[model samples]
Target: MRWWDVEALMPLERELFGDTAWSAEMFWSELSHPETRWYVVAENPETTDVLGYAGLLAPGLEADVQTVAVAPHAQGQGIGRGLLDALIHQARERAATSLLLEVRADNEAAIKLYSARGFERIAIRRRYYQPGDIDAWVMRLRPLT
Candidate 1:
């Protein structure tokens, strides 16, 4: 995603993630690592509105799905899937042998999405999300073959 997109992306980030939303500085920091990081923003084909976004960080043969989000109005429209596919493609391009991600266990839809994409639950982190007691599921997806 371009630097210009961060301003537009932050509101959606807050809307969806609430208190756990990332800050502008965090986005900036992630963006600064272009060699190891990749991020994409999905825009409305007609209106050019930011519909969703995803990010991946690849260091050597290991990669992580840093973030993925679809606007409330844009969910179930294949945007999330598209974003996810893009991330996988990016990881593959970087020769990532495995990809990892953490999803809040309570987020069933997200879990289903990742599961459908072949991610397997590997572990559970006890109350990983702060400001409340929410467990997180650590999931892994092996080399895309």
Candidate 2:
């Protein structure tokens, strides 16, 4: 993602995540740490519309999957997988020995996606999500051989 994409990215973020969505300033702060961060966006080729966005933070041998969101109309079209793949690639590029992420316990689809991508449950963060009693499953993809 570039400086210009923030304008288009924030709206989709709010639509997918609602009140807890990351603010514009938060994105700026993340981008400021390019040495340890990588973010990417997918767009409609014809209209140049934002379809999805994902970010990764690799600090040392560990990498965290910070966020992955897809436009409502664009879900189930491999955009999420593509974004995830990009993150995994970026993590490997950054010399991350393994990758980790957290997903809401209720989000089976996302959990399935991550599981299929080699992430395995390692722990749980109780009541990790706000405004309710939702929990988060902390998953990790083991180090590559």
Among these predictions, the greatest lDDT belongs to 1
Candidate 1 backbone overlaps, count: 0
Tens digit of per-residue lDDT, candidate 2, span 37-65: 99999999999999999999998899999
- List where candidate 1 sits over 4 angstroms from the true fold: none
> Which residue pairs clash in candidate 2?
none
**C-alpha local distance difference test of each model:** 0.94, 0.92
Clash number for candidate 2: 0
Candidate 1, residues 24-114, lDDT tens digits: the string is 8899999999999999999998998899999999998989999999999989898999999999999999999999999999999999999
Cα error of candidate 2 at position 35, Å: 0.2
CA lDDT, candidate 2, residue 25: 90
Model 2 residue 133 CA deviation (Å) reads 1.6
In terms of lDDT, the poorest run of 10 residues in model 2 is 136-145
